[model samples]
Target: MAHETSETTAASSVDAAASSGRRFLRNKVPEVTVSFWIIKVLCTTVGKTAADLLGEKAGHGLTGVSVLMSVLLAVVLVVQFRTTAYRAGVYWSAVALISVVGTLISDSLTDGMGVPLETSATVFAIMLAAVYVVWYRRERTLSIHSIDTTGRESFYWLAVLLTISLSSATGDLVSERMDFGYWLSAVLFALLIAAIALAHFALDLDAVWSFWIAYVLTRPLGASFGDYLSQPTDDGGLGLGTVVTSVLFLGVVLGLVVYPAVTRKDVTQLHQAARQAA
Candidate 1:
């Protein structure tokens, strides 16, 4: 009887450790809500303005800017992926850098190589759709709620990269080719995002679908907003310049990251609730 009890206790300890590890892996993605949207928009906006400032204002040119940002993004992503747990600062910094690189990719093709925005948009959309289809087929779930595994994180980043590229192409197409102007494009995207939000909250759309639709739209919305703030006064902007716009958004994002990191209040509460439900 004594021997049997000792074995049972040992087994229980092992099981507990395994369960804890599993839970840690599963909660990688941040919860989708107002704060998440706000930070995401700020990151994308910073991405657009910062990339322009580096490339045009700094005279690094498109290739130099693209290469520099791409290297930085890769380094950030390495740190982010290697992190055993989510660090808000690392994660958001990676996101901001990725946003800049994605925009650079599209811009290089469109402005440097003279590829049409319409063509780039179509190709990026197709690529993003393919990523989603494959991710779903393999994982059997597209829930951001369950991004704990390496495979899910891979899919998540791939989707994000493609969405950024597509959004850039589409935004440029509307603003430049269609001559809608920055302010008008921003208004149009804002309305579209509002419609998506309404559909999600009021009309009972699936959470995954609603989240993704909103995510894709936010990219263009951020791009348009950045353009509206940073473009020349003659171009209907506030004449703030890209440097000022980038700095403003970066400051906001830094504050958001720091708050979450220091408090850990949000993280603790979320995990506690998840434990209770489980």
Candidate 2:
């Protein structure tokens, strides 16, 4: 009876370990929530203004700023990947840095390399589509909720970078090439996001597609909004300046991130439980 009991306990321990391993895999990313969207938009706004502040205002120029931000982004992502579970600070830091890097990439193509914004947007869209195809083929899903392994997380970040680049290029194309202006461009992207939400809630749009589409739109919306606040009034903005605008949005982001970090509100319940168990 004692030997049988020991065998059963060992078997149970193995099963528990396996369960914990699976849970750990899935906890690397946060759950989607309203706070997620709010922070994402705010981060994009800060991305736009901060990049401008460094590249244009602070005299680093686009090339120097891009190199600096890209290096910083890579470091943050390394920390992000090393973590075992969802951490608001690390994850959002990666997002914010990627946003700046993505914007700089689009800007470099347009202003530095003399590529048209329309062409950049089209090329980025193709790249994004290719990433999606490869990701889905390899992982069998494009849903963020399934970012359970390093491979998935790698794909997720790549898709995110592409989306930000595509959105920046598309926003510039619409606002500059089409002459929509900052305010109108912001409104246009905002409405498109609202439409996506409506379709998801009312018309049964696939949640994954809706989330990805809205995610792409949010960057441009935030960028336009940031430009409207940061540019001079003569240029149709409020004259807040990029420094002020970036600081303001980043402050709000800090405040919002603190709440989730303290409460772990953004971490899924299963993730929290698994983390505690581990």
Candidate 3:
């Protein structure tokens, strides 16, 4: 009886380990790293500049650009959802496109619909909060590390969409409506992100909350930075034009994402057998 029980327990352990490994493999997001943040900031910057390029510079008008980008974002999101694991190319592509689409959503509220940036920011904040409430209630956790199911992934993307919109509105409110200008606004957001990082490392802030806060702040910081570089000198920018700024940032993001994809360096690692045994 002891011998039989031992064999059964070993089989159970093996099965649990395999199940844990499968769960890890199914996670749809990359492991957070320094490269992740760099690529994210660049993606946000490209989001701002590329939206401007299409809407104003390309003569597509805001409505046209919004529609076009929304469709593209939807397509990319479908691909993202279908993937069983995180593919750097697909994941970052979705992020970049969503950034543009999110910017367009905010701009549409402000410019097309005559909504004040303050009002848009407030609404988006409420919506983001609601998403969190629902997500946590359903999943019992908001950690990105647990994004291994379609339902969790849905919540994650919805939260991301709101964050992007909220960030755009907040950035515009500070930089344009409040007369802070682009560069100064970038500095302010950068400082805020740094403070969050400090709190996480030194003050023992919750890791998940720290990550989300930094994620939200990066959107505005990158947007302000992009605007500062692309807007004309008279508008407190270097006058590089949106085209130049978008292309430059996109190139950097592509290179960074490609390296990780090739090397799998940023792939989340899990000691599945140990975890399962525990």
Candidate 4:
């Protein structure tokens, strides 16, 4: 009887471990908050500055930079898709790379192919709208909270790519064509984002609408701030250079990712509470 009980207990433990692993893998989305937004903006700023530094300052040229970044983004995205759980470093690296690639796509269309900003902006907007319509039609919901399924994840990333591309073209058009300058453009987008937030919290806008609006606005806000810091004084910027801006933002993102990795305090606490209740 003692031997049989020991074997059964061991089997039960193994089964429990497997179950726990499966649950962990299924929790795909991160806990959204202020920290998430702050890091996202930092990544966007790095994306703009790093892409420009590589193409213009480092002599990589537009085609070379676009090709290289596009390949890199694809590799990172593959890694992200393969992972069963949310690894902050892998996920955020993919985001940063995609941001750069998205900006490059818009820049190449405008500078290399001579496509008008208005046209690029409109094309991206239509693409994004189509993505949402299809995503909703299939998934029946647009909540970030439930990104565990493969189809939802695909839609989420597609929308993200479109938003970045559209924002890049629109930001450039407003700052350059309208002569609003980088700082003013940043302020304008910030206020627009703030209003969206107000509408979500105070006026009870749909959660999906609030999330998408905020996501789109962050791109322009990040781009404007990036240009304000990196462009020359004659262009109404601080002339900090792309390398410095990239380094600063990259360092912050690395630190934030590392903190969550090492501590794992957030994950641990949540799991512990779940176990206690169970």
Candidate 5:
């Protein structure tokens, strides 16, 4: 009897160790909450202004900036993928970089290929929808809770890229071509996002769908704000310059990310702990 009990104890210990290892492999994406949305918008604003700063103000030109941002994004994403756990810096840096790359792609389609902004926007929207459909079919859930696997993360980032690209094209098309102006465009998108939030919280809308809808809208919301601040006064902006706007938004992003890092307020496990205690 004693010999049999010892063997069972050993088997149980191994199982416990395996379970602990799996816990570390939980989904990496942060929770869908107000902080997440705020930082996302800030990152997108930086995406727009920083792209302009690199390509035009810094005189690297579109190709140079595109290559530079793409390389940086590749490096950041590699680091993010290697970790079994989420690191705030690596994750958010990847996002900011992917944002830059998305902006470059939209600009290339419009300026380099002479594709109309409205057409590019429509094309990107279709691509984003396709990603969502395939991702849902494969995963059976579009919830961020399902992002633990590498495959889900890939789909998530692809969708993010498409949203960023489409938002840029659509924002510029409305603000410049449609003459809505930067301020009005920002307000419009912001209101739409607000409605999504209201519907989700008050009207019992699906959490996942509401989160994604707001997520996509933030790209244009931020882009419009970036354009409003960075463009020349004659171009319907405040004439703050790309450099200033980029620096300002990037600083805010850095600060917000650092807070989450230090407090672990946005980290899934820690967030749950904090909530439980409250």
Candidate 6:
């Protein structure tokens, strides 16, 4: 009876480990797709204009708006993390809030505390690199496909936030400090993203790195694009105003998200490619 009991206990332990491992491998995020990129860029554009509108137009100082928006962001993120499966509404809401907070962080350092754009960009770049190093060291993979575990998801969100800050800083450095017109800056980043896509498709770039490179560049691209429409002609823009730009882009984002939500097209499946074997 004692021997039989010992065998059963060992088997149960094995079963439990297997179950945990399986759960850890199941992705809880959306799959990379065309819709993903479209929504990502649109949300990033909103990040730029919405932050400005809330801070300047909405009758709140940057600090006050940041605090209010941060509270709302916390609630949205809590819902996102508590979900067991990928949810388009929850996921995109989190992304949008991250975009807003990221803009606030970058702007606060530069406009609020007198940090130079170059300095902020360089600092954010280093911070992003550090996150990547620590993440890769612990998980041995930096691919977004394996963000099923709590630790990986945390790392993913941290990376996303850092990337947005870095991108915002860099965008301002090129488009404002350097005095490149908003339209020109938009063209510049669009070309850069095109190059990355070419490298991925034509030259056989690593899929994970390609995805991330494009992702980082889109931040600046969207910022420039947003500013081009929202800023006045005196500043080399289309003079649409923030209200129009925000409403237009957000409507598009809503449409794109609805399609994916109803179709379940972007939901990550139970078994997908992983970097572990590489």
* TM-score per model over all chains: 0.87, 0.90, 0.89, 0.86, 0.87, 0.88
Predicted candidate 6 versus true structure: per-residue lDDT over 15-99, tens digit per residue? 5646667433446678777888889999999989999889787677777888888898889888988886678899999998889
4 against 5, candidate with superior TM-score? 5
Tens digits of lDDT, candidate 3, 19-124: 7774333557887888988899999999999998888866777898899889999999999999977888889999999999999999999999999999999999
**What's model 5's TM-score?**
0.87
Q: Between prediction 2 and prediction 5, which has the larger TM-score?
A: 2
Worst 10 residues of 2 by lDDT: 1-10
- Candidate 5 positional error at 23, Å: 6.3
Steric clash pairs (candidate 6): none
How many angstroms is residue 11 displaced in model 6 relative to the true structure, after the best TM-score fit?
A: 24
Predicted structure with the largest lDDT when compared to the true one: 3
Q: Tell me each candidate's RMSD, in Å, in order.
A: 8.0, 7.6, 7.0, 8.8, 8.5, 8.7
Q: Judging by lDDT, tell me the better candidate of 2 and 5.
A: 2
Per-residue lDDT tens digits for candidate 4, residues 74-122, read 8988888887656788888988998998999999999999999999999
* Stretches > 4 Å off in candidate 3: 1-25, 271-278
lDDT of 4 at 1: 6
Residue 110 of model 1 has an lDDT of 91
Candidate 5 clashes between residue pairs 3 or more apart in a chain or in different chains: none
Compute the lDDT for candidate 4: 0.80
- Candidate 6 regions with alpha-carbon error over 4 angstroms: 1-21, 269-278
> Between candidates 2 and 3, which one is better according to lDDT?
3
Looking at model 6, residue 200 earns an lDDT score of: 76
Estimate, for each residue in 7-69, the C-alpha lDDT of model 2 and write its tens digit: 344345445757667434545766677888889999999999988888876577789889989
Q: lDDT of all predictions, in order shown?
A: 0.80, 0.85, 0.86, 0.80, 0.81, 0.83
Candidate 4 ranges beyond 4 A from true positions: 1-25, 262-278
